[model samples]
Structures are given as structure tokens and as C-alpha cells.
Target: MKIHDIPGFPNPLRVRVVLAAKGLLDKVDFVPVDLPGAEHKRPPFLAINPTGTVPVLELDDGTYISECTAITEYLDNLDGNPILTGKTALEKAMVHMMQKRAESELIDAIGIYFHHATPGLGEALQPYKHPEWEGRTYWGEMHREKALAGMHYFDSVLRKQPYIAGDFFSMADATVLGGLLFAFYAQIPVPSALTALLEWKERVDQLPAVIQASA
Candidate 1:
């Protein structure tokens, strides 16, 4: 399989972390897309993913899979012994639930703040964004607030358990890690009072897979 992605970018890094965790990092080829050049919006890349997103997984038989969650699912199950996603029915449901929350409340929220609130990639990509109605700064601030709320929610969850989805480090934890990455780039500060979440992040950073992926 060939993974098309821009290294260090949040979503792509999410996939990379999963690959590292599954011990499949060396098994696949990494194709770097010129995100700064808006190459993802062009034809050749768009053909692989109509959404024009990075981190597309191209299978050996010519199948293309987009979306971080979907790609993670495929990779996790590829060995027939799922780890990052989950195994049992309840585990699957809980992990997925937290994953969605992580995406919507944190990662995706940070994305909105970055692209809409701030000067995103550049003027070259501006045409793809929606016209500012309430004002870009106003909308950006709103998204920032949402991301902060997400952090608090996760902090509360971590206070109760060691991981996002019960005891194990699942996809939900990966999603939160990705969200924190995005938050760093977006310059969104985590609340100082969310000590549990902060400590949880330190623990995640120590994982060999995370360290490898971040490297």
C-alpha cells in the first residue's frame, strides 16, 4: 500500500501513528503531497480522493481509501487482530463514540479555527473557503472556544480512566493526540486547570509508536 500524505500534518500524522502502532510503517510507501502548493486540489490527486484531502491509502489492487478513521479501521483490522480500534462489540462502540467526539469537538474544531479564523494555507486556497459573514475573526474565536470545551471534556474523561476509551489506548486516544497536534499548530492553548488531560498527553508522548510517528 502507498500512503499519500503531507508529513507532520495532523490528519496524516494520525494515520502514521496508527501505522507505527500496528508495526506496518515499514511495509508501506509514503508519498508526500505538496499541500502548500495546493496540489491536493488539482486533478491527479483529486482522482485518488475527490475530497482533495491528504493521507489517502492506495491499495495494491488500486483501491483508494480516504478519511483518517476509515483508513485506521482498515489498517487495524488488516492483521485480523485489531488493537487500535477495538475487538469486542462494546469496545468497538465506545471507541468509535469517543473517536467521533474527538474529531468533532477537538480536531475538526481546531481545523475550522485554523482555516476560517486565521489566514489558512494562503490566498491561493482562499477561494475554496466560504465567504466570511459574521467576520473571520469572530468565527475563528467561536471555533477556538469549542476546541477549549473539548479539552475540558476530555480532561474530565481522563480523570476517570487512564485512556479515552476505558483502560486501553485505542483509536479514540489517537484522535485526541491528533487534535492536540492541530491545537499546537493553531496556537490554541489548553486550559491550565486541565491537569489530567495534560498528564495524559505526557503519557501518550512516551509511547514508542507516538514517538516514532512524531519523528
Candidate 2:
């Protein structure tokens, strides 16, 4: 398998962490996509993925897979352990539920906020800002409020449970982690009152898979 993405960014980092968790990092070759250069947005890459996104997984069988959720589903089911997703029917339901919430309420909202505020998280991330999106301010402030609400929601969820979905660390947890990373880059501060969320982040940061991926 080949992972076409630039390392260190939020969405790409999500899939890379999943690979590390599944012990599949060593098996997959990483092809860097020039996100700043608009390589992924052009016809050459668009032919591979119409969505024109990063962290696309190209299989050995000559098939391309996009989206973190779908890529994660493929990886989790591959080894049959499926610990990062879910095993039982109810577990899958719970994981998916939280996963969607994590994406919509947190990651996706932050992406909109940051992209509109400036291209590529602006000065937060070097070499990601495109010339077109520079100095362009849209409805980013509105999404900033939305992202803050998302942080509060997740904090409340963490206060009630050991993990985002339930007892086990599922894909939802990874999505939240990625969102938080993006929030940090976007300079969206997580309030000091959200101690539970901070504690959860600290705990997950120590996990072997997360540590490996971050490294």
C-alpha cells in the first residue's frame, strides 16, 4: 500500500496514526503530495481521487481509497483485530456514532474555520498557505465559535467516559486527537475549564501507537 500525503498535517496524521496502531506503517510506502503547490488539486492527482484530498491510500491491487474513515475501515478489517474500530455490532454502532460527531463537530468545523481564516492554517503551519487564500477572511469567525462549542461538547463527553466512544480507544478518539492538533495550529485555545479533555489528550498521547505516529 502507498499513502499519498504530506506528514504532520491533521487529516494525514490521523491516517498515519491508524497505520502505526495497526503495525502497518512499515509495510506501506509514503508518497508525498505537494499540498502547497496545488498538486493534489490538479488533474494529475484528481484522476486518482476526485475529492482531491490527502492521505489517500493506494492499494497494491491498483485501487485508490480516500477519506480517513473509509481508509481506517479498510485497515481495521484487514488484520481482523479491528480494535481501533469495533468488533461487536453494538460496538461498531457506538464507535461510528462518536466518530461522526468527532468529524462534524470538531475536525470539519476547525477545517472550515482555519481555511477561511487563511489558507493552510496560515502562519500556524509553514509552507501550506496558498497564494489565493492568503488574506482572505470569510465566515471563519462563525466556525471558530462552532469549534469552541465542539471542544466543550467533547470535554463533557470525556468527563463521562473513559474514551470518546466507550471503554475502548476507537477511531473516534483518533479523530478528536486530530481535531485538537488542528485547533492548536489554528490557535483555537481549549479553555482551561475543560480539564477532562486535557487529561484525555495527555493519556492518549502516551499510547504507544500515538507516540510512534507522532515521532
Candidate 3:
């Protein structure tokens, strides 16, 4: 399997963390996409993934998978260990629910601010080409504020449980980890009010898998 990814991008980090957690890093070849030159939008890359998103998974047979969640689910199904996703039926539901919330409330929110409000990259993103998100400048700011609130929400929840869904480390944790990392990278300071979340992040960061995947 070949994973088209970007070093400094958060979306690709999500898959990298999952692969690390599953101990499948060596099983897949990691290909770094050239983002600075808009290579993803060009011919060869687009032929593989019309969406032109990073972290695309290409099978040896020539099939391609885009979208972070789809790729994760595909990889998780490959092995019997469902710990990263969930084991029980209820666990699966909760994990998926929490993952969706994190994406909507935090990850996508931070992405908006990063891609739109930030200038150089914003101009390169070609937002004008997609009119649906034309006025996203203001929307990105709004989403950013909501993302901050969502961080506090997660922090408060972490105060009671060991992980996002519960005591078990699941996809929810991975999602939040990637999201928080992006937020911090984008200059969105971690709120001091969420002391528990801060501690939890420190613990998560110390894991060998997280360390290796990040490296």
C-alpha cells in the first residue's frame, strides 16, 4: 500500500497516528506530496485522487482511497484488532459519534482558519474557485471560536475519563490528538482552563507509537 501524505499537514498525521497505533507503519510506503508547488492539483496526482487531498491510500492493485475516515476504516478492517475503532457495538457507535464531533467542532474548524484566514496558503488554496466557501473568511473565524469552545468541552470530559470515549483508547483519542496538534501549530494556544486535557495530551504524546509516527 502507498500512502500519499504531507509532512506538515494534519490530515496526513491522522492516518500516520492510526498506522502507528496499529503497528503497521512498515507495511505501508509513505509518499510525501509536494504541497508548496500545488503538485496535488496537477495531472498525475489528480489521476490518482481527483479530490487532490493528501493521505490518499493506493492499493497495489491500483485502487485508491481518499478521505481520512474512509481510509482509516479500510485499514482498521484489514486486521481483526478493532481497538482503534471499537470492539463492541455500543463502543463502535460512541467512537464514531465522538470522532464526528471532533472533526466538525475542532479539526474542520481549525482547518478553515488555517486555510482561509492565513494569507499565503489561503491564496494558494484557491477558495475562489469553490464559490460555496467563498465567504469562508468570516466563517473560519467563527469556526475557530467554536473550536476553542470544543477544546474546553473535551478538556472537561477528560477530567472524568481516561480517554475521550472512556477508559479505552479509541479513534476519538487519535482524532483529538491530531486536531489539537494542528490548532497548536496554527498558533491557537491551548486554553489553560482545560488543565485535564493538557495533562491528557502530555500522556498521549509520551506513547511510543505517537512518538514514532510523529518522527
Stretches of model 2 off by over 4 angstroms after superposition:
119-138
- How many angstroms is residue 203 displaced in model 2 relative to the true structure, after the best TM-score fit? 0.6
**Relative to the true structure, how large is the alpha-carbon lDDT of every model?**
0.92, 0.88, 0.82
| Cα error, candidate 2, residue 89 (Å) | 1.1
TM-score, candidate number 2? 0.92
Candidate 2 local lDDT, 130-213, one digit each (tens): 435534455666778888999999999999999999999989999999999999989898999999999999999999889988
For candidate 3, write residues 2-49 as lDDT tens digits: 899986577887888888888888999988888766778888999989
TM for candidate 1 is 0.96
lDDT, candidate 3, residue 4?
94
lDDT: which candidate is best? 1
Per-residue error for 158 in candidate 2, Å, reads 0.5
What TM-score fits each model? Answer: 0.96, 0.92, 0.91
Candidate 1 per-residue lDDT, tens place, 1-215, comes to: 99999889999889989999999999999999988788899999999899999889999999999999999999999989999888999999999999999999999999989988888788777777664555877787799999999999999999999999999998889899999989999888788899999999999999998998988
**Candidate 3 displacement at residue 97 in angstroms:** 0.4
